[model samples]
Target: MNSGAKDRPSTSFSGVIRQNFATKISLCLLMALTIVVGANYGWRRGLLVVVGGLLGVALYYSSFGFTSAWRLLVFERRGAGVQAQLVMLAIAVTLFFPLLAVGEVFGQSLQGFVNPVSVTVALGAFLFGIGMQLAGGCASGTLFSVGGGDSRTLLTLFSFITGATVVTFHLPWWKTLPNLGAISLVDQFGWIVALALSLCVFTALFVLVGKFSTRETRSLVDDGPVDWLRSPWPLLWGAVALALLNATVLVLSGRPWGITGAFSKWGGHALHAVGIDLSSYPYWAEYDFGRSLLGDVPTTTSLGIILGAVASAGLLGKFNPTLRISKRGAITAIVGGLMMGYGGRLAFGCNIGALFGGIASGSLHGWLWLVCGFVGSIFGVFLRKQLGDGPYRNTQPQVEAAKP
Candidate 1:
């Protein structure tokens, strides 16, 4: 109604309605807002903002390297296994040192947000990885896939939430890691010295791997040698992207990104608030890590994930009605979900927070989880085969089936 509105064409305002990377970027910005509103890791460590950004970039790329790491590990190809992961990690951790030094530049020593190695944390993370391999999705993968229209993933997601809730019900009886007063990596060793050695060692390893490496055929991961940017690539790119997103999550959110805890926290809180006091909460509090195992992170994010998936699927003309495996599959999902939830609660994170987050953070425990998880993967694969494609009941395979 105003004269200023009359002067300009509505095209500009209508342009915003168009879909493209602009919308994607804008959505990412919205996600960042979630950090401002929900994250607990305030700017205490944000004292050295510049170095922190650099450190964040390093973290992002390390996780990016991790995208191809698992496939390379499961199937050998040019020693891409740990070399890529380590190279990126070394670069990430080395650069992180300067941030530590510069962080103290303001004479305000910031606390480093890192968890130390513990058998319990490692084992729990391994369990989570096994869950992913068996279920055919990681936490972020499940979120995005379910968002993108994979019913199996949605089924898996339901179990994931249920499992987390189950664990929360018994959290007091599950904790095991000693929350060693928050330790920063630089404090344990001289920042400069740590950076120099890690860089030298890892770079050398990269060279060694590349030299003796046997280039294998392409795996499911686009890492083999194919352009996945133009059209929608396989799950590989999605995996790497999630890893990168996680690093930013740490930079912006302080603590590592995780899904199980949030789920468990919500479930627990919901139960507690609904005049349905489950005796489980108090009983489970005795565990070393039993607290908040069931209910924590915002349900809005999850709701967005699921709804986003359905919408994306529908927009892509991929949505349909179907169920996963059979009754046995459903039971397995529920039980596995229970294990994953409780196990993640036992640890401080699941795949996102511990495995991916730990590896990016350069924690020794992360590798432990990876190894243990692979061990668990052996079992998961066996179960999948035994189940003989139990559920994954595809309604429109040609239209919307995701690879396992």
Candidate 2:
């Protein structure tokens, strides 16, 4: 431990200050941006940006990840991460159901992210699952990880943007595909029944998955004192914070939290800048793509997430950026990112927008996303093994021995 310390700066007051330089810088930038947003956009939008920031902080501090959680469950049979997700879903659905049922809150009309159960959705979600494993992160995961200075994910993000944009050219074809249309559980059944059913599903998943974990393992949730200022947060805290923040988003934005929509928007803007006309595309025309950049809630909130992640990484003294990626890793990241971006668009969203937000909003499509995505993830795990990626490649199946 002493040797490790010697390899880096000391943990004294001055050293601590030195380590947090990035944190201070990120906070200042975040504040300036927030002020700008508040001045131009409404205070409500500004507040949403803050909520996005808090989400980023929670995500980074807890290292709460959808991609790795699925991979761990598929490859190692470790279900703790997936279990934490269940807890998050449980909390979110509880809050979302009643609010969605109300329909109107503080003069804001509320709605869930219900989308069609279609062939496109099924294939898209499966591809997204595979992309996440290969790229090493999901939509939110990609944003936060890139913001936290994982340079490799930067490559992935660029590819993601490109892929999302490329798919717009093919959207007309996909729309022609058979779609069952949107199904909202809250609308179909009463909110009470929807909530009960959601809870039961969550409970069933929790129990069924728990049986696979024969030994205790460290997970996002930790059982001990946590230094909120700098240390990693307990996963449970992250889960609750995410749930509450998502609920707050629904109240403020009239919809639950989403991330990938902004990615597509950004991609559109980039293409437009390059003198490409996408306005003729049905998808872009439908959304009125001529709007000013960052004029929407999703874009601003997504930006906030990245900045917030940067701040969190700074606070934790982990904001080291590097572009040192292996050739194979780079190839995989690009390919995976493209798949995630394209698939997410087809599926109507990524893990956050589709799975978390969808389910919490009582959308049947969310459940479909979960099932299909997990199946894709199982294949992804094997693919990763074939690519020589890590423990999945070398390690044999065995329970971790209990530590003495």
Candidate 3:
């Protein structure tokens, strides 16, 4: 133990014993749950769960989060996170387009999350941006935080589900907004051309951010032999890993990784369990509503993420959960989560689903989502300043980690 261990009274015998017992019990339950579910389903679903768990591990260790990256860029003009995103996008587009064109990765069919360029996408992404700021996390951020033992995120998750469920009832009206339907660069142009175009955009972003960046933030990544198991991974390495994981999702699931859609589904199921009928909803009818309400790929993957986050946080000695939060903060979390859920439905995805996955797949809607989402984030930042804590309101200044 560290020299200061004795100085911290919170690590008392009772507390330590209780926490350790809880952690062990939680781990056992999670493992048993995964095994039972996988055995009942199939190997493919099991693998997907593993992938989600691994993704959670990667996200937690890396701190390669989109919400903070955007927040830092908009508020502080810090572009390191933005640069990392561009790197990830560039790598994803390069790999994804080529593989998608081939139509199979080891015999698994591949597809992308292509959506229409529409008014809803623009408005939806903007709303989602503001929600993420207010909520203190995006879709992926929420799930991982919950896994990492954040009690606040549980509220965010609940609100998100509620908001998503509400959107289903009004989706028909939202869909009526003018749309161009799904458009893909790879479909219009060849994979080679699409890749080139994507790279050019990434290069432009790189140059623009580079010109404006005053200080390059060093990542917390260590290059030691056991660094892979460590927290605070290098930004670039995290970005690369996320890109590969997302591409792997496309190959395995025949679609890019999405977060909020499953949330909405789960929310709907919750309603149904209480004797509410959702079959009449147009959104549910478009897909196999009843069957989907039962666990699907996305939902299982999400479940995996929470447990994975839990495992990672526990291993790192960071699994601290507290119910202490100001009333104002709690309200903000609920509202933020609601906005994310509703906006994600309107936009066809959240930050991970639309912005990251969409753009990587060469969809124009994805680009629109970013522009609109960023605009919303600007408003969110302003609202955060007025109503609650803004991203820049931190008392401690951020110190960049030493370069590897």
lDDT of each: 0.49, 0.82, 0.79
Q: How well is each residue in 1-404 modelled by candidate 1, as lDDT tens digits? A: 11222222224433333323333643454445335433443443222222222222222222233322443444344354445455445544544456545554344442233565665665676676556555655565566555444456667777777777776544454444454433434556667765666577668866876676566433224444534322224333444444444444344434445566667656655566676656545743443343432122233334444444433333333333345456656655555565566566556666556665555454556556666765665555446546654212234332212222
TM-score of each: 0.62, 0.92, 0.89
lDDT of model 1, residue 248: 43
| Segments of candidate 1 deviating more than 4 angstroms | 1-72, 75-113, 169-185, 196-230, 233-244, 278-325, 390-404
Candidates 2 and 3 compared by TM-score, better number: 2
Which runs in model 2 stand beyond 4 Å of their true positions? 1-18, 219-221, 286-290, 395-404
lDDT of 2: 0.82
lDDT of 3 by residue, 37-117 (tens): 668776565667777877787887777777777776665667888888899999999888888888877767887888899
lDDT of 2 by residue, 1-404 (tens): 01122223336776567558767877787777778778887788878879988988999888788887777675667777788899999999999999999998999999989999999989999999888888888888888898788877998999988888788789889988998889999999999999999899899999998998754455655777789967888778888999999999999989988877888888888777788876678777766646665568888788888989988887777676767888878988998899999999989899998999999999888989998888887777678669966235544423211110
Model 1 CA lDDT for position 323: 54
Q: If ranked by lDDT, best first, what sequence of candidates would result?
A: 2, 3, 1
Residue 120 CA displacement from its true place in model 2, Å: 0.5
